[model samples]
Target: MTAADLALLDEEVTHCRACPRLVEWRERVAREKRAAFRDQTYWGRPVPGFGPADARILILGLAPAAHGANRTGRMFTGDRSGEVLYAALYRAGLATRPVSVSADDDLRLIGTRITAPVKCAPPANKPEPAERDNCAHWLRRELRDLAELKVVVTLGAFAWAAWWMALEPVYGVRPPTPRPRFGHGVVHQMPGLPAVLGSYHVSQQNTFTGRLTPAMLDDVFRQARSLAGEESRG
Candidate 1:
């Protein structure tokens, strides 16, 4: 990412108050848990996309976690959800490190990038449709900036739907027949710039209960890497 792009992202994230409900909830979380994260300033602001701007594979997560990305200002950082995600990314050979504690940490992605449909941590982790719509601009801008994007891996049903809807315009065509469904290892080749892949979100419930195991999630990334012209070790 260039300095200009980073600066623009920083400006957008810092001043993002598009959704009042998310703003209030994020502020409350920061206030309530001040001591535990006193040294870490909450990026309770909108979370920005992380990793290479020219990434060929973009992973779309549902939203930021209350104490995860919201607290750390980075996508998929500082929480149980990220723990599951980073582990799978590492196993898939897309990530150098298997941990994402904070944005300042030295973690890196090779051909993949991570982002969310809703940038801010929503109340109860559920965002209203209007709030999601408000945040779509950021998603659109991010996708536009990814000039070499060839694949997108949506981490849940909601994220899958959001990306599918957004890409229709970009591709200038109707979605493919039997639209992609959400599963552990579902893949969709759309008539677009990038093929869309689906995977169950690596949330706490899915990870802890074995609904979405690390190996299963890693398989999705393996598919993504393959589509992006990278070899998959799995």
Candidate 2:
């Protein structure tokens, strides 16, 4: 896939209004400003995935947080989860900074790209089955565009499922039966596709409960880097 194709897709994604439910909810949240970010203008539109077109590692998240990415217009920004996720990424040598505050934060990733299955923020942090299926088109297109990707780190079960499902259409292969389960540090290798590594989402629920710790995230990202390094050499 070429950079032009990814750029074109990014442009198209931002203007998408295919899912009415997502469209309504995202706009509603933007209109009713959060107390902490009352003075800031919210971006009530689909958030495009960001990173270099040739990145070898793809980080998948579930969806935008109502007051986080939906507010900052960048995935995993302006929120508690980003604080945890970026800190671990920095420690693993993937990110240049330990925090992601805004879309223009100048935080860079090495050999990695980040995206979400659902582009818009959903009410109550849950997207229905139809919304996911509709959004899968954008994700599959992205997977095809990231021609050099060799590893995928799914932030939760939803992301794990989305990544695996995308591979079938993006790479033209039927998945193995009894789909791989999600778990912290679980790795699944599929031929002609990026190896998928599962991690509990960097959400507050997981991080606060100690279900996903800094060490846990580091272990996953470290292995992801190693795998990407090997692919680059190959």
Candidate 3:
């Protein structure tokens, strides 16, 4: 598929309101306005994936943050989790910069893309099963369109599961029986499928509690780059 096709899919994603609860929650958060961002306008719509159409590395996240991507209109932007993620990407030579604050920023991904299964921000960062299914087609499209994709670095178990769910239809293969369990630094490889590398979510809850550190995240991306056959630039 061409970049224009991906762009069209992105446009469709932004206009989606298939899940009433997610639509209500995302809109409510936008309207309520977080105290720190009261002066800025909220995107309030479904956020689309970021990066090139031919990306070799795909970073799969759970969903957009209520005040982060929901306010900035870009996946993983304007949030602590984004800070950690982009920084690691930069270290891994996958991004142009170590920070991702806004969609309009000069930040860029190099042979890398980031997206989520659930497009809209959900209440308390939790997306319901029905909502996830509602948003699955978008992810399937993205997977189908990223023709050069070689690796999928899933952030947390939710994204790992979503990766398998989205992959089944795209590749016409079910996940291996017993399924590869999710764990930081875990790797799962199957013929005719992009390798899956698991990582802890870049949330403050993980970072602040000494569960996920810079070195750890960097290592995950290091492995991801290796799996993607990317040369080390860090």
Q: Give the TM-score ranking, best first.
A: 3, 2, 1
As a whole number from 0 to 100, the lDDT of residue 72 in candidate 2 is 97
Which pairs of residues collide in model 3?
none
Question: What is the alpha-carbon lDDT of model 2 when measured against the actual structure?
Answer: 0.90
In candidate 1, which residue ranges exceed 4 Å CA deviation? 1-3, 34-39, 232-234
Residue 203 of candidate 1: its Cα lDDT? 86
The TM-score of candidate 1 is: 0.91
Off by over 4 Å in 2: 230-234
Of 2 and 3, which scores higher on TM-score? 3
- lDDT per residue for candidate 2 within 1-234, as digits (tens), equals 788999999889999999999999999999998999999999989998978799999999999999999999989999999999889888877788999999998998877889999999998899999999999999999998999999999999999999878876888887778887888889988766789999999999999999988888888988898877743442
The lDDT leader among the candidates is 3
- TM-score winner, 1 or 3: 3
Which candidate would rank higher by TM-score, 1 or 2?
2
CA displacement after TM-score superposition, residue 131 of candidate 3 (Å): 0.7
Task: Count clashing pairs, candidate 1.
Answer: 0
lDDT of each: 0.82, 0.90, 0.93
The list of candidate 3 runs beyond 4 A from truth reads 232-234
